[model samples]
Target chain A: MQKDSFRVRAADLLDIPADIKGGLLHIEITGKREVFIENHKGILELSENEVTLNAGKETVRVLGQRLRVLAMNNNEIRLSGIIESVGFVREGSSCSQL
Target chain B: MQSAVNFVRGSVLLEVKSSYPERFFNLCARHGIEFWDMTNDGLGVFRIRMTVKNFKRIRPVARKAMCRVHIVKRCGLPFFLNRFRKRAALISGCAVFCIIAWIFTSFVWVIDIDGYAELDTARLLNELSKQGLRVGTYAPSVEMENLKNNILIDMPELSYISVNINGSHAHVTARKRTLPPEILPSELPCDIISDKDGIIHDITVKSGTPEVVRGETVTRGQILASGYVTGRAGTTITTHADAEIRARVWRKKSARMPKKYSEKVYTGREKDLYTILLFDNRIKLYINSGISYTKCDKIIKRTDLRLFGRYRLPISLERATCREYEISKASVSDETAYDSLSKGLMSSLELPEDAEVINADFITSSDEVFAYATLTAESIEPIGTKREILRNG
Candidate 1:
């Protein structure tokens, strides 16, 4: 808890955004047609209905229909199709919170 | 945009079959090897497009990920060059053709003369050649202004001339000089006689003696004024006769206007013929041969290509349209004939400005008609005749 408080204070002091300071993955959705994820580690599970990505400390699960992995590199990955919802799951935390 | 760049540099599509294809992407990114357009086949195979430079680097990453990589397709200029590397003659021929085209365009290949009907084309072309404006000559070497002046000095018959160079063609336009009416000098002894039979109305003698008076009838060739002015003491002064005599003259002019006349009427039917003109030779491409028109008039239109709106090409396309016409008999009333005859007679008459038409009498026959018109005119015309005296009159 103290380390977490120190990290938050250091983030405020350094004038860095939360997503950048924590090395969190940034997800951008354009009108539910496309989704872009930056700073992703790798794909944990991929399918037409659901795509789960390792984004730093959390797992980003994307639920959609006919979801396609349009393009990908180390920095970012672009997903296209009907995106219904995006849920984040922390380690030892239930996935239903997000 | 990225795909277009990659296509030019040459790229390949790879099909990677693995349980975890995402690991291959992460490995490629870690090695700074960029790839895009990734697709998951949902059956443990993923298709991705990557540049040729990075394709070899991806093998190690695919091996580490335990994914089997296979080239699905290869594209771009590198592939094209490899496929056509054996056709040496075709490549050289294309190069030679391009070089020849460029060289030919630098010189004038065609000389076209427009608006020159009365002037001789051969003579104009010879003069143009002397002035460095001719076919097969360098287009930029011809000085247009200097050539224009030189041509005008050499050919006084041409009033205006313009030289235009369009691509591989040279266009020359010129206008002919119109000469003034001929006049005879009054140095020789001459006679002024009546041209037609008339009743003398007035006479004005400038250097001659008056012969006829008003109300006096004069026939054709009758002298209205005398050139010999007899001075005092019987010594006659032979002079160039000058006089103005106005007379009321009558003339009969007739035109046969049949009640029914055969005329050529346009039927609005036409046939077209197309031809290609290369240099001076013409090759007919399409023509209608079955046309049977009793009378037809043909109109021809020739078009040549102009490059950059300034240069003209030697090649031309010609289209000839033949409009068909037929002879048909038509009838008209006497009143219509009279109106037509009046207009026709008026146009044919060379009457003076102040002349007055007194009366017109028309005599219409079954197949012919005659018109007798009496006119009065005020004229300043010489009517005196001079005959050389043979030492005794």
Candidate 2:
């Protein structure tokens, strides 16, 4: 985990996108209509109001209304609905990233 | 459009049932089994759409995820083609129709000529027919550029020409040469003189001074009207003479009719010949043995097969009917000859339609009869011959 954070910090210092570094998860949100998570492990939970995706050491939760998995693969999952908020929970940590 | 293409390429709607359908989707994604439009039905059943090829590849992955996959619908060309194979005649008929249409389009059926005037239409058609541009001509065999050049070379009167072949019709357009104006003799000052000796029945003067009045006896070469006119101011003006003179003329016509004549009578012997005409070539299909008819008249009829009431095929069936007649000698009585001679003399005079027949006399001789008729006809013919005016300088 320390090594991953150091790599992310190095990427940020070098003014390079973190998604290109291969270890970080890439999440793209289009307004409140859709959420695309790349470089993810699997779909951990799915429901009408929210969807939780496992992205390596982080758990990404998308909160919305009438959420559905539009498409999914091994490393990517696309969720579509009226997305209200998104939160990421790092494994073994209480710090929240939104 | 994308879904239609997918349907054409074969796609299936699938329902995956399991405790964790999400795990099944992830497994599908891992194995590159592409799917879209995923919706979760209640109680662990998920519906999705995938290509037929990808759906087949997802069986092992679904087994590993402890899920059961069921096909809800199948679509696309292959499935529709399996149904289409049952009607063999319909499919073959469509194919044959296409081939026939293609073959017929390659031939010219109707030849149309446009923008033509002052030229004999039949003569122009005859010239074009010689160049193989007539109806039923094969389009590919016709070189349009060469044909235009040939037409221009053959018809010097044509100023502009073009040959256009559209679909099954060839349109030929041409412009004829305009001739120069004519200089007529009436433009000169002349006198209208009498060409025959008769009593004047009527006289009409358009641009001349009248010299003779109606009911006056005139001899040949006598001036009926003069081009020199005296105006109201007593000035003499020279003009082109134009006049029409109708006169009461006497004509004597005679005709001799022979007492013996021969007429043709039907012999009841006939023959029929059948032939096939392909374009300009004729092939006889039936033969007659010793067709020796002394006097016979033959009639031929040709029929062509047309497609859709407009397209005429080159092939045609021709039927020739020949009827034989025999000459029989018959003797006409003197009375019959007298009657025929009178009618013959009336027609031989070629008198005017309103001509008054004054008298008819018939004289019969041996083996021949003669009839004479005197007719007074109102003739409106242009009997005035132009005479140059003598100028006294």
Candidate 3:
């Protein structure tokens, strides 16, 4: 935890993206239709209505209707189809809220 | 666009039935197996598309995930070609057709000649054939500059020539040499002579002395205007004679038509013969039985097969239509024969456009086998013609 905090502070002080320095997931959402996640760990759970992914420190859950994995590779996961909301569940946190 | 890439690379659609499908997805992602269009069917069944190479690598992933992967559909070029592997004849036919098409397109099929006026097309084509530029000649072997030069040297009448070969068609354009106009000696002493025996009605001499006055009778070859002109000092100077002499000319023309004539009467009976032309060889499609009609007309229509309405193919279809007819004797009425003969005689007269006809009389006569009409007419027309005066050196 100390090492992660020092890395975040260094990234902020040096004006660098934390995702690049701290290995954080970089998620980009486009108009509630598509969500592209870079620096992903793997898919945790997948279904038609929702998708959950392991993003190193947090579990990212995508809630949508007829959600699908458009494309997936080691570092990237692209989800499409009527995305409703995205909530992040940190370690030991309940799945109720972000 | 990605689908096109997948199709070219050969992809397979797989249906995964597993208790834990998310593990299968994560295993595929961890193994760097790119997949797309993933969907869930709600009964623990999911569908996804992956490349053929990745599908081969998915056996370990499927085993690790405890998933049974079934190929729902196989798509792309390899699968499509494998489906036709059993039909050997069809594949060979397609191969042969492509080979034949390639071979046919390598040679010239059509030769288009343009810009030819007064020059005979057949003669030009014959000349071109002699120089190895005719139809069916290999297009790449044609040396255009040498061919043009050879043809120009062989036929001096062609001033400019260009040969352009586009695919199986060769377009040859040529311009004919324009001959210079004839140069006449205007300084030569000449006389205006009467070309026909006529009574002089008017005479206008431009550069010579008038030899005949109005109402004077002149015969053919008689000089109407003399080339010798008396100058103001009474000195005789020879000059070219130019004059327009209008005179009353008499002409007679006669035409005869046979009273009995043979006319062609169609019997309404016809027969069709078909032929197939493959390149230069003609194959008769119809059986060769002797023609039944004694007198018939054979009309042949040839249709050339083409590709895309532009590329001419060597194969063609020919249909010969034979129409039977019989000859029947027919006689013309006296009045009809007289009218026909009179029209023929008038057309045969070959009167000038500006001539004015003063009087005309037609005499009709009939013989045992023929009817005749004679036309006698008097017209006022220009009768002067130039005749050069030959002087001894």
Candidate 4:
């Protein structure tokens, strides 16, 4: 945790984007229909209603209806459907509600 | 769309039946296997599309994930061509058609000639054929400069000639040579002579002494003006004679017409003969026997076959139509015969445009089968014609 905080402070001092400097996850959502996740580890869970992916430091879960994996490659995953909400699950903790 | 790119590179749609579908998906992603349009059916079955090459490399990943992958569909050019592998005739036909198209476009099929006046086109075509530039000749083999020079040498009447080959057509543009105007030497001494028997009605001399006056009768070959001029100090100076002499002349013409004439009456009988022409070879579609009708008119028409309404083919169809008629004798009234004879005599009397006719009279006579008429007319016309004066040393 201390190392991560020092890296974040260095990024702030240098005016660099935290996602690129710290190798953090970058998520882009378009309306309520699509979501693009970059810097992802892999898919943890996939279903018609929800999809959970492993980011570097946390787990990202997307809740939606008729959810599908539109495309997936090494570093990015694209999910598409009528998105309802998004939440995060920290290590050794249950899901944090959105 | 990515689908279009995948279709060109050959793609496969596979259905994966796995108890752990998420592990299969994550394995595919972790190994850098590109896939799209992935869907889950809640029955441990998932469908996804990927390129054929990438699909071939996903076997190990699928085995590690304990999934059964079955290709549901295959789409692309290789699979499409495999369907026609057993039909040899279609493949050969396509190859033959392509070869024929290439051969046809390499040679000249049509020859178009333009700007030719007072020169026969068939004769020029014959000359061009002799010079190795005819239809069906290979276009690339023709040496344009040499062909132009040889043609100009063979036919000097052509002032300018150009040969342009565009695709399967050869365009030949030519211009006929124009003869220069005749130059007359005005410094030489000349005299004006009377060309017909007449009485001089008017005389105007510009540069010489007048030999004949008004109301004077003159015969053919008589000089109407002299080229000798009396200059100062009694010196006789020679000059070119210029004059306009008008005279009164008489003309007579006669014509004859028959009271009974033979006219043709068609009986509505015709025969058509066809012949097929391939290049210079003529193939007669009918047997060669002389025409049955002795007194018949033949109308021949030639139609050239063309491709796509533009490229002219070497083959043509010729149709000859023979129409038959019969001759019948007919009689006319004496007044009608006389009028016809008079019209013929008037047309036969060719006069100059400036000649003014003063009086005309016709005499008519008829026998049993023939009628004759005589016409006499009087007119005033110019009578001067130039004659170069011959001087002896």
Best candidate according to DockQ: 3
lDDT of 4 by residue, B1-393 (tens): 865666678878899999888888888888889899898778878999888888989999999999999999988866777788999999999999999988988899889999986899998999899899997899999889999999999999999999999888899999899989654478989888999998999999998889999999999999999888898789987789999999998889987888899988877899999999987889989896478887888899999998898678888999999889889999988899889888887777777788888877999999998888889988898997877887872
Model 3 chain B weakest lDDT span, ten residues long: B179-188
lDDT per residue, candidate 2, B1-393, as tens digits? 987888788878899889887788778887988787877765778788888889879879988999999999887887787787999998999999999988888888766788886787787788887877887778889987777878888999988888888878788888997777653476688888988877887899998898988988888989999989999999998877888777766555555655667888888888888899876788998765356886887888888767787656667899887889988887877666667766766567665555555544545454343333332233433456667776762
Model 4: per-residue Cα lDDT at residue B31: 85
Compare the candidates by lDDT and give the number of the best one. 3
- Candidate 3 residue lDDT tens string, B134-219: 76899999999999999999999999999999989898999999989764378999888988999999998999999999999999
Error of 4 at B280 (Å): 1.5
Look at candidate 4 and give me any clashing residue pairs.
none
Cα error of candidate 1 at position B166, Å:
4.7
Off by over 4 Å in 4: A1-98, B1-9, B19-46, B177-264, B287-291, B329-393
The candidate with the higher DockQ, 2 or 4, is: 4
**iRMS, all models:** 1.9, 1.5, 0.9, 0.9
lDDT of 1 at B328: 90
The candidate that achieves the highest TM-score relative to the unseen native structure: 3
Ranking according to DockQ, highest score first: 3, 4, 2, 1
Per-prediction TM-score = 0.54, 0.52, 0.74, 0.65
Ranked candidates (TM-score, high to low): 3, 4, 1, 2
**Candidate 4, DockQ score (0 to 1):** 0.65
| lDDT, candidates in the order shown | 0.77, 0.78, 0.89, 0.88
